[model samples]
Target chain A: MTDSEKGENQEMLDVFFEASRAQDPVPGSDLMARILADASQVQAGFNPAPAVVSHPSAGQPGQTLLSRIFAVMGGWAGASALTASVCIGVLYGATAPDTVRSYLPALDEQTAELDYSYLGLLDETVADLEG
Target chain B: MMPLDTNDDISDDALMVLFANGDGQAASVLAYRHTGRVLALALRMLGDKAEAEDVAQDALMRLWKIAPDWRQGEAKVSTWLYRVASNLCTDRLRKQGGKRASEDIDNVPEPKDDAPSIESDLIARDRANALQAALETLPVRQRKAVSLRFLQELANPEVAEIMEISVEAVESLLARGKRGLAEALEAQKMELGLDT
Candidate 1:
């Protein structure tokens, strides 16, 4: 097409588009309300920064360092790990003596005096019986 | 930390930053500012009011979610929104398998104020409907390029940004779309009493 023809065609399309532009729909209140509701729900938990339980400046001015550790580790993951560690320590304390006694038979009171004085005779008897 | 009543004075990027910083009203401002364009784009792309509304809501919801991580100076919020809405429209069009699945004028609900006020306005409305029908006959990409570039009056660069294509590609699409629209409009000109 010639430049004039192209220009005219473009002008024509412009007019058509301008006319149609007015008919474009505006979003209604209900849609806005729904969007705002989503925003509210999302913003409910949105903090500008992550939690800082262990910060040096956190808690009372005279608080001890140990208190800070407990405060910081009080969250779910930290609390769960602490609980598991305590349970394991208690379990080991409860079962360690019995496990050691079984492994070392002399530690058993019933078997503490089983010394055989005639070791040579016993070995000779065992050999002769096998023969 | 943005003060209330400051929304109107702040840029969209600023509003987004405020929203990310836990300002709830910032979200409301962004949504109100951008929903019209998003809805209009979806409506033109999908040709269904309800689907367009859904697409608009989904796009803005994505925007809301991305507020925290929104990098300043990366892109304009409006351009980002147009892109999201465009992608959604494409996904919907792809799911339906073709542009033929888009709703036609009879099925799509138009605003009551869209009714013609005069004979010329009536012709314009008819031509617009014809244009929309012709647009739906196009491949999804071409339709999107044409709608965004011509109807939405976005610059070639902005259209490229929204369509995620190079400027030359956008120009090519616009040329092809214009040809198709011209041909379609030519067929209906006499019937609609438009100037030749």
Candidate 2:
């Protein structure tokens, strides 16, 4: 098209294009509502799930104090072993075994003498034996 | 206290991120901000308000879905919406049997009696209807280029991005499309009050 014709055509089309702009439709309220509802629904999936926080020092949140103590003592096995040891100690103390007295120095003036000669044998060198 | 976010100043890109992070207010703000333009473009493309509304809603819905993966600088959210709405309109246009839903310009509906009756308002409405009718005559790509470039008042490069074509290609299509529109409406010029 000639430049003159082109300018004329553009001018004419500009009018129509302008009218089209003025005529741009407003979306109805229902449409806006639907759009937002869709957005919200889709966004529902986007929310990061709340982090599961474990308190390091709080043990288990719901466990009883006795249960926590049991856990600290290594469950039932440790508790049973501790109970058995306490009972054995009580029996030995009550009965006053000579075997127990043999290891410890006497509370009275008399003492259970421990031999140092046996320790001297342990100190003897393999070289002395070989010689 | 942090001031309540009017979100008026927030860019659409940031709004999309907030939306993805489950900020309902951000979604609300972005939806209101963009859906109108998207609807307008779809209206131009499909030439039917209901269909255009459907296209707009679908585009935003896709935006919501894509928000989690939205690469902030890759494309503006509004530009992305335009591209999505344009593509959706294109799909529907193709399935339209290569013919407009309203085939005859003669059948363009008269304004409702309940509508505003100002002379200028009526004139502008008539002219728009005529243009819309004429637009449906060109090929889909031509129509899209014309709508985005002229009626929607988007820059050439932005149109290219939306159409996924080069700016040069967009200019060429616009040239041809305007020519086609002028020819189609030339016969109706006097009726449309373009004789001025």
Q: Score each candidate by Cα lDDT.
A: 0.81, 0.83
Best by TM-score: 2
Where does candidate 2 stray beyond 4 Å?
Answer: A48-131, B1-5, B103-117
* TM per prediction: 0.69, 0.73
TM-score for chain B in model 2: 0.90
User: Residue pairs in steric clash, candidate 1?
Assistant: none
lDDT of 1 by residue, B56-119 (tens): 9999888888888889999999999999999999999899887364455553435447455777
Give Cα distance to truth, residue B93, candidate 1, Å.
0.3
Alpha-carbon shift of residue B146 in model 1 (angstroms): 0.9
Go through the candidates in order and give the clash count of each.
Answer: 0, 0
Residues A61-123 of candidate 1: C-alpha lDDT, one tens digit per residue: 787888777778875688889999999999988979778667888556656677776998999
DockQ in order: 0.31, 0.41
Model 2 C-alpha lDDT per residue in residues B1-196, reported as the tens digit of each score: 1122653887778777777776778877888789988998998888887788899999999998999899988998888999999999999998887768663453333344445558977887888888998998999999999999898899999999999999999999998998999899889889877786
